[model samples]
Target: MPRAGRPASPLITRRAAADAALSLIDSGGLDGLSLQAVARVLGVSAPSLYHHFRDKEELLTQVARCFLEEIGHQQERWSDDWETRTIELSLATRRVALRHPNAAPLALRFFPRKLMLPAYERSLVDCPYPPQFHAVILEAVEKFTYGSALFAAAAEAHHTPAMPPVDEAHFPYLASAIAAAPASDEDLHVEALRALLDGFRVRYGPRQR
Candidate 1:
């Protein structure tokens, strides 16, 4: 049975439900998540969850926005070189994804939707490049970030196994790199992210090589 007039505190109702949903993702991978599960955890009717978020997609978007807002908060906290700030943003978000592996796939798309646009918009607004040329810079940066985030999230969700041991003689370079660098899945992912940032610097940073 259920007992409810509107919650005594509407904001608490919404935040409690959202946090519960995120907690469920933390406890059980995304496959284990459902709006009903969130409502049950929060001791509310599922309709109440709907009131806060139109659908699961909106819920996911809100979660992703929460993640972006966290990044913005961190950026505000530190004044640092832009490259370091960018790395901190990427690595911190990766840690957040690892913490809530279930919700990551849904959350990853937020980069293109909300994160990158304002960044590119600000650059276009401030930089010397013409709009057409700035679009090139935007395109290059997005291709890397979008691809890397999705790939890392999927890998973590799937618990993708490390590259299997292999005959080094057959694939010399890859084998040597794997053995010498010895990437845990997370390490490979972070390094790959750094590589993308490096590419962007060459293409878009001052004194491009």
Candidate 2:
């Protein structure tokens, strides 16, 4: 939608401010953004923002919560392989973060709000894994998802390339694995996760002996 008029009222005023803040962060990194910046973009007094938010942290919390809620909402009707739930959710999260790459880091973790946490809990409850295993599995998946995206995005956008390495002797399997799946971040994340679960099954899943 085009931005061409004043916000209709207090309700939209707050949402307008949030949308402006998102744009500011996307244009300039989060470090370059500020509440005053958002307020200016919204054509409102900086202090007026306080009418809707207690402080920058409060505003950021709202922004982060909104992103998480969007991610949760998008996955509300998923019907894919149950084992792939975490992977698909991680991908959905990446898609959300991609929309606000500058704020991607902030969207890296689940919002801690009661309303948001319950949604995550509900997803876990529906997963095939038991609670104890689900927690461990999801935690590991989220870490890889966020961490890979961070490094990958930075490397692609700003970092210089490093020389490729060559290894042979005792690292044959490691080399084969890398060759089998290329070094692209998402591919690496998926391959690593698959290897992890495969290893888990072999080592711990109802030992065949």
Total clashing pairs for each candidate: 1, 0
- Overall local distance difference test of candidate 1: 0.63
Residues 104-127 of candidate 2 have per-residue lDDT tens digits of 666644354566566467667656
Where model 1 places Cα greater than 4 Å from the true spot, the runs are 1-8, 11-13, 74-76, 109-116, 119-133, 182-209
Q: Pick the candidate with the highest TM-score.
A: 2
The TM-score, computed over Cα atoms with residue i paired to residue i, of candidate 1 is 0.71
**lDDT score at residue 171, model 1, on the 0-100 scale:** 93
TM-score of 2: 0.73
Per-residue lDDT over 1-209 for candidate 1, one digit per residue giving the tens place of the 0 to 100 score: 33486545553355566677678876786678788998888776777687678888776666666655554555445334555555566666666656556666666554336465775565455544445566665565555554665566666777784356678889999887777883475566667767866765565567834
Q: List the residue pairs that clash in candidate 1.
A: 30-102
Once model 2 is optimally superposed onto the true structure by TM-score, how far is the C-alpha of residue 51 displaced, in angstroms? 0.5
